[model samples]
Target: MNASPEDPLSQRPSRIRVDLDRLSHNLRSIRAHVGVPVMGIVKANAYGHGLVPVARHIQAQGVEQLGVAFLEEGIVLRQAGITLPILVMGGIFGRQAVQFIEHDLEVTVSSLDKLRQIEAAAEALGRKAVIHLKIDTGMERIGVHSYSAAPFIEAAVASRWCELKGIYSHLACADDPGSPMTLQQLERFQEACAHFERIGAPMPLRHLANSGGILHFPQTHLDMVRPGIMLYGVLPDPVSRRTVDVKPVLSLTSQVIYFKVVKAGNPVSYGATWAPTRNTRVVTVPIGYGDGYPRGLSSRGQVLIRGHAYPVVGRVCMDQFMVDIGDDSAWNEDEVVLIGEQGDAAITVESLAQAAGMSAYEVLVGLNLRIPREYRYS
Candidate 1:
């Protein structure tokens, strides 16, 4: 069924359906595989699957904690009445540390200065600020350098108002089990942990495995594991797909709102990039780059209609695109599958990413909020 006529989602021609049961199953599978507390990564609007709903669902499934990229994201979850421990995994501005304390959000300490700011914020609030110290094993995007992490760890340990809750480092290449860099980063993180132990500092909860690490490097699963994409049933890397058993949890779909026949030699859409070689039937779907469908897929994209594959034969516009359905007669409101299975055919996120010259992460998170997400539990 497309949608009931009274359903608000049906009012929009395009929507993303999220299977929460599949999400829960993925979480169970991941937790079983890692045998550790899972800190569900719900950042980027739960990788564009819907943040609060996803977070609430994961929490209900017994997730010990949640991770978000920014303090505001954490605050949003808090405002939604989520009481689960949430860690803000992004870099923090010194002035914003108080919000972390006030909201009871765990802060990520990447530098000594940020640590002091958090300490002061906690002191002023008459509360303790829980934090995870991020060490730069690789990815160089954030976190203190592992070799130079002692001072930061020492400061965190010494702080009266800041509680060192955990220590973590991001993996740069855990997706490729064959890459020695992951092992190298693991060693560096271990050395940093040893430094903490040698200083007689309380060793905080240690975690280093992301989705890729959780699937490929079992040893990296320490006190806990932070999984993002895999929890949504998408592999962190294509190679990991062979090693893990999970289902895709999201499907982008739209309804065919208009259909017409194009005479041979007539151009299809803007820029005149494609023309029908023979008189054929074409259908317009109410989805485009404006809906986070990649514009790059313009002429290269494919969609499923009536269980048949149809090529997206024109430049993807701001709000609509056309597909050549051959000579088959199509009518308004015909179901179109953009990133899901239809009969024997399927178009996956990975395939769409390849067509758009982007990553699966990009394709998932790039899904604009304009497309309402409808939840399903079966």
Candidate 2:
């Protein structure tokens, strides 16, 4: 069976299908387990799931808050009439503060210096900006130092121009079981929370869990959960060997541009990294590194055709690659899947990430906007 004839292009080839049903299922499962208000991290286009559609779907699934990485992303959601509470996870710098205040979006104040700048900006705009004081914990990337958190929290809470809506911290090693660093960071966050509560700093909502923390440590759930990859149905870490049995939502499919019978000893692809030792049927797919398929997948990548698994041959080029389709039912210049279900076989994003030496987040986020993302409800 194939796609409908009315929309030949949809059924024909060269499109990525988004499974909203799978997405909804994953959202429900995560919400049930996490047991807190989830701020669906839809930044980077919901990890390349198409921002507006995924955000709308997330809204439909009952998530009231959405998190993004930049001010522009939050603006886009606001323009789309999302109306839900959006927390800009990334710091807003320079003149972006006014836009954040105007849109009524919450932002993370990572540095006291940045907070000061924002306060000045809010005064200029004659509006109160809601901000969250971020604690560095052990990430060492952003946020105020745990020791200095007291003063920062006090200043923000007392600032008439700024509204201290919440306090948050990012976890650095929540995925690693033996990383005692998580415990140390948790203790620091707790102490900071206690300090805020004692001094009446008004840290109404406290959160510190990313996807890894939500899955591994229940105690860290606190008042909210910010999950990114897991909501899109990818495990936070592969080493833990946890499989959720949830369906993946994205399908990268293309077509076999051409088919050729190669004689023995004919080297394939650039650098001739792979050569045919025997007469083989080579199936060429029109998808490569240019489309976010990593070049590192060269000979390590796998694809499904007619319920059979075939190894990718040679180096993946910028726009094309060859697969060893072998002597199966004939293949022609038609739709072929490079990263999706083909009959009973499937190439999951996790498998592709492993083959490309990248994380699941990298694999999904690497998908360029040029690739058309088609969404379906069923």
Candidate 3:
């Protein structure tokens, strides 16, 4: 294994390196392709890419708005000096409505009660709360039902303290372009907007395209587009990757901190799940389920070292894991790649997700706060 005497990265066992240039490129590419304003999704710590830093980078790239799942996330961006428009996309409790106006964050009005609460808060605060009306076309998780959204829209449009800034719906199956449900949702959204026009309600900026919809359904790109995973250079599904041109922005890497020899028949890790048939070189990496590396990966995971792949031999511990590198004389401080290129070999997030029996979104967002994030550009 290649070793560096004075490499600073060798001091930390694991970290996530984020490529800002690629992130900016992806944002620009998506905007150019969609030809509309972009709302960069920065929820879940920017999907584990470091929320504030990623948001700052995206804001510098001239994105029109930022999206987060919680009101607290929007507050964080505002506290970090982000002045761009921020919309909290998740359903909110009525009590949290005041924070939206206080922080100048946009609210997602999912129900009439929530809208009334926001209006009340805005009136009491003497500030208008800008909002995006969320309609539930098929995804039953959040949003008002499309067929039942007329009153919601009318109330917001007529409210004196609420600014109806936009109307949107989540795409349930945009990853599968052939899925008829996407078309059905689109029809429902379009019809709902038409209803607003029929009643002479000022048509708010309409948006329905997410990363998947942006790639598979250009017609759904109304006034603005919200690109979440694609902004991080990951497609919502493998099939979408065939048509979307983007690059992965984050790489999980580590260094071998301990190495030893294990004798034949000796079991490894928590459950004694793996045993060596012969003498083997066992290298310990200081990362585990505690660091957001999936414990389910356990014996099924692989890591790249010195341009080759090695099997993880045991249950991934809370703060460390073991890899049997065979008899390869790999030593401490050797580079270990868990989700990035190593010489001619590489481990993509998709591969890691498959090994862990999880989705790519989970793999990315699940990366814990323990690992430091190193940012780079160019």
Candidate 4:
């Protein structure tokens, strides 16, 4: 919404604003709280804030490491000249072994087959491949099960062409501070790590804490902690406590493109899902599901305009949506705050997610690359 003559606004009225200062604040807060190295998770396009920019900024903040969900995400960071220790947490295909080594990326060795693939690639190139052993304590999504991980750990520890840099496991219930499942998974992971000591092998760096763990479980903060949504100043769940002092780093805003008065009992937008009993002032915003604004927010969401909050009037369209302002005055091009503060009012990601009937993660990463992103510090 801050426009100038030289750096004018684009033809589109909606955009996502990223606060880099808030990101730095969150990183520092998490680091100080955990008292360990922080692997800033920038997966899913940095939670839809812009991948390259966010990673670049945080890397400059001197984060210890970085994590992503896919191989291509790491490759993209490398292409952008991000020279930092990046761990590709997803499973690796045999064909990607060479690419991973060439890019100087850390691989997640979830199984013996994956370890063999990396070893072969590294030996063929006469180079050492850095890897982390993944133990499946829970979240049956990936990694070798802790019950049967001894052989896999032994094989990885004996790999000649690979360097075992670290070992880790994903927490399935870390988001729920009261869930006993987290401690159970932690016990299983500790048991798996004990294998390294049992065989007289040095234990690699151990990391298991996630955002929820970072907030609630201090015991899980082993050698490092990976903070994803919390890094962006958003909680992973509705009941998540704000143990760390952090502010939102991203805000969504738009402008009123059209303004008109609707007749009494006349439906607005599609499907005639909502109408006012009396005539009212309505404004159209140039953003909708196409831009990742949830269609479920139709008539359920609220936006701040002219320092006042107004309800969405009807079904959200692909390219636009309607808002009822009643007798309040709002001219064309008036600033509209969708997920940010306007005067004394503010709309948060958690509230918006509740209105959309989606999780906080879905509300964030669901915002595709359709909307332009601008970065600021104030």
Question: What's each prediction's TM-score?
Answer: 0.96, 0.94, 0.95, 0.97
Rank order by lDDT, top first? 4, 1, 3, 2
TM value for model 3 = 0.95
Q: Which of 2 and 4 is the better model by TM-score?
A: 4
Could you give candidate 4's per-residue lDDT for residues 256-303 as a string of tens digits?
Answer: 999999999999989999999999999999999988999999889999
RMSD of each: 2.0, 2.9, 3.3, 1.9
lDDT of 4: 0.93
Tens digit per residue, CA lDDT, model 2, 301-335: 98777667888999999988989877765467556
Candidate 1 lDDT tens digits, 1-378: 235778775689799999989998898888888888999999999999999999888888999999999999999999999999999999999989889898989999999988889888899999999989999998899999999988888888889998888999999999887889999999999999998779987789999999889988998999999999888888776666445577899999999999899999999889999998999988999988988999999999899988888899989999999999887877898889999888999999988988988888999999988898888987
Q: Output the number of the TM-score-best candidate.
A: 4
Candidate topping lDDT: 4
Candidate 3 least-lDDT 10 residues: 1-10
User: Which consecutive 10 residues in model 1 have the weakest lDDT in total?
Assistant: 236-245
Name the candidate, 2 or 3, with the larger TM-score value: 3
Give candidate 2's TM-score: 0.94
Q: After superposition, which runs of candidate 3 have C-alpha atoms over 4 Å from their true positions?
A: 1-11
